[model samples]
Target: MRTMLVADDDPHIRSLLRQVLTGEGYQVLEAADGLEARERLEAAPVDLAILDVMMPGLDGLELCRIIRDTYDIPIILLTARQQLSDKEQGFLQGTDDYVTKPFEPEELLFRIKALFRRYDVPSLDKIRIGRVLIDRRNYEITAGDETLLLPVKEFELLAQLAQYPGRLFSRSELIERVWGLDYEGDDRTVDVHIKRLRQRFAEHDGSFRIRTIRGIGYKLEAGNA
Candidate 1:
């Protein structure tokens, strides 16, 4: 199920959106302000965010910018302003769409659906495992305060494994997925890349680990699990 974060200061607005969003089969996470929204995002992965522009303790536009820098989720800004300049600012802050206040719930729903369709490409998404973020959009990994870019093959390998944490993937299956089925190569190539990933993330061992299944293949395990 897709998860959505609703960050708005008004209780009535949050309750209304919750009802509408939940009725559509989406899991909803609520926050009274931008700070709580950020905390919710860090605690759990969300597919999209809906932020209210007039929120206290961190307005929507600033929070939108922070989310753009860290995550690859679509954002829709809700505001009372109808000025063209206001809409432009939201777009510049990385919002995918906007809905002015006194708007119909149906209109907001349509905008959300449109944004999801636009970002349906996997390359525009991100996979988060524990503290590690595999950002296919930028081909970067953010672990705590440090960000690193891996080689194409290495990044692909990790991203694939992280996509299904704790799911076993045989060497042949991995090669076909990451290296492509047409490429003829030794299965040990998988081992080499896995080794490099482990070495590269040795310091962040508490976050996640790549486990070798000995005779079978490998699987990624979240440290907390």
Candidate 2:
């Protein structure tokens, strides 16, 4: 059976979600706050999580980041705030969907079904190599407690290599896939970005390193992180 985790500080809301989801033939997991949710999340195979934005400890956004950095699971935020900025922040933190509070149970159920159709939720979003997490979805590189944000092109370049660890990509292919034809610089530009990316990861003490394939391109290799 498909599993869904419902996390909220309020018992009534949790009960409501459990009732709604359970009736729809989903096995429901319950957590009172983000911390408890994380504990439960780490212990089980949860298909999806519905999280309240405000919670004791971690909070929903922080929990969402951790989940995105390590798991393939899809997330939906349950919040009272309807502001566009708040929703945008949730998305940047790696949440896939959002439903404001006081929403109809049936509508929420429909949204969950739609997300399942859109995303291959079982497919991993972030690639973990030892202590470092290469998060392609959010353009985030996280190692332990530290998280680094990279420029779009640099992030895409890193993500491209991460998608197929140890696979070689020629400089031309990297430019075409990451920089695109719109890029005005020569192949040296790829080397320049690679150097900068390496330096940035070094500063963050990442466990993985990008290895040059001599005359070919580059690949991600995990050393003593």
Candidate 3:
């Protein structure tokens, strides 16, 4: 069974998430704040985390940075702030997805399911495409002697493309598989992440490329095949 940790200062939010996740067949762990959540994470591994932005100490952003630095677990941030800058910051800080405070529970559940379906435990250890090595367990990507630290979305998008080399995926399809079908963002986000991934690969003298299908979308080229 997959385990999920819910960290929120609001008792109401914690209870609601627990009820919904439990019904969806997930083992739920609850924490009232960032400090408590950190302790829980240290004691046991969780497949995903639902973090609230406003907390007594550490804060969701800080906690997320710590989690990203320490573990490869997926994170979905919950915040009342609806600013684009806030969302971008969360994504840049290694959050896999973001949910606004007045969110639909079903949307959150859908995102969780989407993430699990794509990057479950069985595929979490390592993913290799030609000479490019993605250590999903450690969140490290290596091409020959150079290792690259990818942001969360970049890693997820690359992993999805790697799963089926040479298979094209439209922007909508990539958004559905990687950012969740219910994600409320523009398709431009996918393009931005792909651009970043290509830059990282180039820095390491790696030619493992994501092919653009012009009006369609993208595909991972078989660099060694």
Candidate 4:
């Protein structure tokens, strides 16, 4: 089932959303505030997010920007405000759609379906190396029974390598693929993230290893499980 997050400060609103979303067969996750919503996202991935604009602590626009920078998912902003500036800000922050308050549940459901169709939702791109499972759909890695969520860049870097085990990738390629072709940062950024990934997985049983190709780049190889 596709998972959707509904974040709002009002309990009644959250409850109503949960009902409407669940009735449509989408699994619903809720957060009472913006910060809690962020925590929920980091711990578990959702296919789409519906965020209230007036949320306390890390409000919707800021949260939308943060999520957009990290995950490839659709976001819809819900607000009572009808100001054109508010709508513009939401779009600038990367919201896929904006829904005004007191909307018909049916209308919201129709919008949700349209977004799903547009984005081609429900695809899982996953790779397995020994006991490790890299799930691109959820932006999560599972090693045996433990699930780990890495920083967005770290996860993307690792996912790229895991997708083609034993295939070498140059720093330039990695930066282009993971950090985007427009990134203007130092190439050593890859080196720093790779180091962190190594440290993060050092304690796990040998299910996979990322090997540096000295002067060239890196590759992922299946290890003893």
Best by lDDT: 1
Question: What TM-scores do the predictions have?
Answer: 0.62, 0.56, 0.55, 0.57
Task: Estimate every model's Cα lDDT from 0 to 1.
Answer: 0.88, 0.82, 0.83, 0.86
lDDT of 1 by residue, 78-98 (tens): 999999999999999999999
Q: Over 4 Å off in model 3, which ranges?
A: 121-225
lDDT of 3: 0.83
Candidate 4 residue pairs in backbone clash: none
| Candidate numbers, best TM-score first, in rank order | 1, 4, 2, 3
lDDT of 3 by residue, 1-225 (tens): 677999999999999999999998999999999999998776554679999988887799999998886566789999999999999999988999999989999999889988877666455468777778888778788887778888888998998887655555678778987899689999999899998888777744344688786776887765652
Best TM-score among the predictions, by candidate number:
1
lDDT of 2 by residue, 44-124 (tens): 557789999999987999998888875566799999999999999999999999999899999999999998887654347
| Superposed Cα deviation of residue 2, candidate 2 (Å) | 0.6
Model 2 RMSD, rounded to 1 decimal: 13.7
Candidate 2 vs 4: which has more lDDT: 4
**Residue 115 in candidate 1 has what lDDT?**
90
Q: How well is each residue in 10-122 modelled by candidate 4, as lDDT tens digits?
A: 89999999999988888999998899999877655477999999989989999999888756678999999999999999999999999999899899999999998988844
Extract clashing residue pairs from model 2. Answer: none
1 against 4, candidate with superior TM-score? 1
**Worst 10 contiguous positions by lDDT, candidate 4:** 161-170
Worst 10 residues of 3 by lDDT: 199-208
Sort all candidates by lDDT, best to worst: 1, 4, 3, 2
